[model samples]
Target: MSDLSPTEVVEIEICRRPIFVVGSQRSGTTILASSLRHHGALWYSTEGYILNEIFGPERLDETYAVARLNLNRWLAREGVTREEFLERMGLGFNVLLSSRSGGKRWIEKTPENSLMIEVLGTMFPGACFIHILRDGRGAVNSMVNKRTAPGWVTDITWACRAWRRYVDAALEYAASHPDRCLTVRYEELVADPEEGFEAIYQFIGVPYDRAPMDFFRTHRTSSSFRRRIRSRSSHEALADLWDVWPLQFKRIFLEDAGVAMLRYGMVSEEEMQQMVEDARDPSDESPSWTEELEGYRSRRDLAAVVERGVPRDAVMLVVSKGDERLLELGDREAWHFPRDEDGGHPGYHPADSEEAIARLEWLRARGAEYLVFPEGSLWWLEHYTGFRDHLAARYPRVVDELDKCMIYGLQSVRQVPTA
Candidate 1:
């Protein structure tokens, strides 16, 4: 700090390729960036705006002229050409990042970075960009629901256009620099994270490690926001919302995002036409079902049920459907039902009641003291009748409320005949 000028400090050669994770807001960019932050070789920051601030298109011609004149004067006084100034700025960014990166490569994430891909590519020629794309409907729905900031887009048309704009910008950049950029779909990544993250690591020229995949287990994003709007399964929730949106909203979304959706294979022409027709004559316009869906999504009462009913220090197996919210509700230890060998969520329900019973016995044998079925997963009781009967005939019900959850005390196993 005492020995060198800012210019002198920024002269260090940049040796590593920085990773830029760019995507539309609410397109899983935060989750992706948070996961990558767990990688030992990468240092991730919330958002980097310097590049965009310096290179973004000016909104007003007068402001642009004044800014350019002042910038040129400063550059002339500093005795550096514009290109040299840019090079040093890039190096300076790297130096600052490297300081906190602990000698590892650095990663930056910002939804707005989707629009600054060309500038980023020019500044860091060796940079790797991961463009995460989500289904436009889901992205727009989330954007409209979670209008967290004052200037955030809330209208259907504006949200749809914004999502398409970011997606098109990133995809356009990826098309030209295929070697340096990779586009990852949010749905595919959620479905099979191992394959997705493996490809990501390979593209970024880093050794693949399984630790980063555990980020979902360790990280919780906006629990309050999630409790308000998110469902146990985002894919299913989005599908339900799409089915219920009015005809006008659907047309607006399609007009702004239809082509991009087709490009991603999210919807075909036949399906798009079918969706439009279906929206025109929705079978159920009653608000009751929508309210029920929202109630199911919220899980507000379920949290209270878990916190109040589940005993402290009990090892519980929860039929969570990959939602991690319940995992944080109590002091007890919780594991997803039908969990993998590593205790991670299996991401799907058992194929049959027999399999469900087998998984239950497996977890019980491994010291699972209680079994929980949250409100969202109560369908398992009806769907897996044999498993439900076995539990009812054997383990005593510790907590059962129609609107909340069902908990079975698994202190002792009894040989009960299945129906």
Candidate 2:
């Protein structure tokens, strides 16, 4: 418990000049945050989760709700001023970040923050926001490559459409409160980070410096994590980033990220037609539905934890011996534990008791950030006397989900204060 009383805690301001980076998912928010973290005046989050950590993701729902009754109960228990409760509940995290800040303000990035203008604005009055805009094609392609797109988002057309909707809502919110928001295009940022970052610093009311542009060389990060966040090669900036989406979306490359994407809020008819033409008209042999579904599920498991933002050195414990094979394609695998010739399957469930709590702690002791039960392969262990649920009941969290195949993080359960 805080030594400070509840009233005093409510009065205390935790973060001054909070900065949030928001935009469509996969729109370079992470890269932007990683680079900005190099600045002397900013402490970017390693836990890449946004304000929701303080608000909620405490349950699994696409719409992000636990229950109306639960919300009311929390409101009653914590007191009516949600902001005060939020600040107090979040005090530990704030203290931790402040220690990490080097006297700088905190800069938080979570693509989902794009939908959270009003809540964020309320939480941190006059806080600055940087919204990074990527061309829809590039964003879609990247989502497919990273497999972070939500389950319903199937192909390039749907992906682009989803981008259009999200970008519209986020930018509209930003426009409503112009002084606090700055929208930067991804192409421009990667093309000339020094100038781009200068504009960013100016918008966020910080001194422009050369540190961020040289982040890769100067900043401290693991070799693998360093390798992952490295800025894109200018050479790869071909017209627009293009890779052929197999089957449905075909070879849709937006060398310029397409002019149409820029007009998401006020798209002209001609631009819409051009975008449709770009995504379709030609097709390759589509992968079977089973193949696509499996791939989606595989990536879904990965994204559940990775999207939460993790320390560069976080280590994932893959439950299956050969499950690591699926990691070949994407750069997010930087979070994977070092290939332990010693670490593979756990061999077998405990003979003493089927309960997995002891096993979980054992894995945590061995430096596991998350435990992946790929494709429900660990059903025997998880289903043992509702072991997953038993642990979840004791340690409720945003990541406290009971899925047959999911990435259950050891760090996740610890987010809640024991008291």
Candidate 3:
């Protein structure tokens, strides 16, 4: 302010800045990153995992540099050169930002970015951070409910330890980089996103426009950007809707992550463990009563999704009868098809043929040893009538390329079925 030049001011106005969002898995980092990405020039990904995969699982002095180098090479492979790459890298990031049209800033996001904030700071001194905080109890509950990595919720104690490690590591980095960090609570963001986004937009020097809200009105496809927006809004709303979760949900959540909950101001520890103990062993005469009830319900109500009929030693295809492989290997000894109606032929529709070819292509891509083809009357009639000729032409060489295996069916067939 004392003697700032006009040129410097102008440069600052147009310059791009790096933004990093950090948090444990399932802690609303994606929503924050995406919300910002919706209207900003930044880019980010869910969790790049590149740093962990390439430079080694633990952080090291050379890890950050190696990550940056790999990213640059990846970009170059995608047709960006050194100078252009640097400019774009500074401008924006996303899980994959190559498709972002008309954005000036580079943005990329990975939760592990927090672990390397110091290294990132050294490389790009202007990097700013958005650290998301979810209530530890809620976070733990969410993690437990999720299909997680093995042993994630075997006990509350281990969950607490894992949750604390990530949160504490993030906090330590943010503490050192006060000027470059913004701590955003998930509850606050969901409750008043405009208020939250305002803070974020100001921090990142982006123009805040509600125009992107209209983007939400369009029907979102399964994997499109709009899908990401809709999913976030739905998740946030559900979090608010679960205000009346059972006492068990709360106790399990708290017991699992109560320490981190206290550190983040979500709870106070003086809250006795007696409450949890009482819940777990509700003095209901028999200790195994609850287990018995669960077992009974599972046996009586739940569909037998896990088919026990398939012998442990026999190879189970669990396929549809109309599946070409089903007919082709009608009498094959090695293959076993599902007995259920739905698991059999889904019919000879155009989509079915296309789906079959796609499945074959996928199998080929994954290095399949055998190709299965059904030989039902419907399949033969369709094949003879060129029902799937277009697909055959498209993937002409797929069937011929199996050097190691043969086209076989679940059961051996005497002859191709004719309509």
Q: What does each candidate score in C-alpha RMSD? A: 20.6, 20.8, 21.6
- The clash tally of candidate 3 reads 39
Highest TM-score scorer: 1
Those runs of model 2 whose alpha carbons end farther than 4 Å from true positions after fitting are 1-13, 53-93, 147-158, 216-247, 250-262, 265-273, 276-419
- Which model is ahead, 2 or 3, in terms of TM-score? 2
Each prediction's whole-model lDDT (CA): 0.76, 0.57, 0.48
Positional deviation of 343 in candidate 1, in angstroms? 64
Q: Between 1 and 3, whose lDDT is larger? A: 1
lDDT of 3 by residue, 1-419 (tens): 57866565322223235567777666777666665556755554445665434433234444334545675565434654433433343333322344443445545566666565555554455667788877665565556555544674645556555566667777777777778877887767766666777787788777876633333223211221133333555444344423444555545554455445544655333432332344454554443433433332332221121122222233333233443333222222222222223434344433455555555444434333333332222243255344245334433222221222112322222344468
Worst 10 residues of 3 by lDDT: 397-406
TM-score of each: 0.57, 0.48, 0.44
Could you tell me how far off, in angstroms, the CA of residue 13 lies in candidate 1 after the best superposition? Answer: 6.5
Q: Candidate 1, residues 1-419: lDDT per residue as tens digits?
A: 48756674334545469899999988888888888988888888677776666656332233334545774666445665544545555676777787777778888888887886776675676788999998888788778777474455778888898898899899988988899899998878876788999999999998987878788445635422244235546566565677767777776775677656755678765766566556443654542323432443346567678778877878988888877766655467888887888889888889999999999988888999988888778899999999989898889998989777899999986777668
Candidate 2 residue-wise lDDT, 97-125, digit = tens: 66777778888777766765556665566
lDDT of 3: 0.48
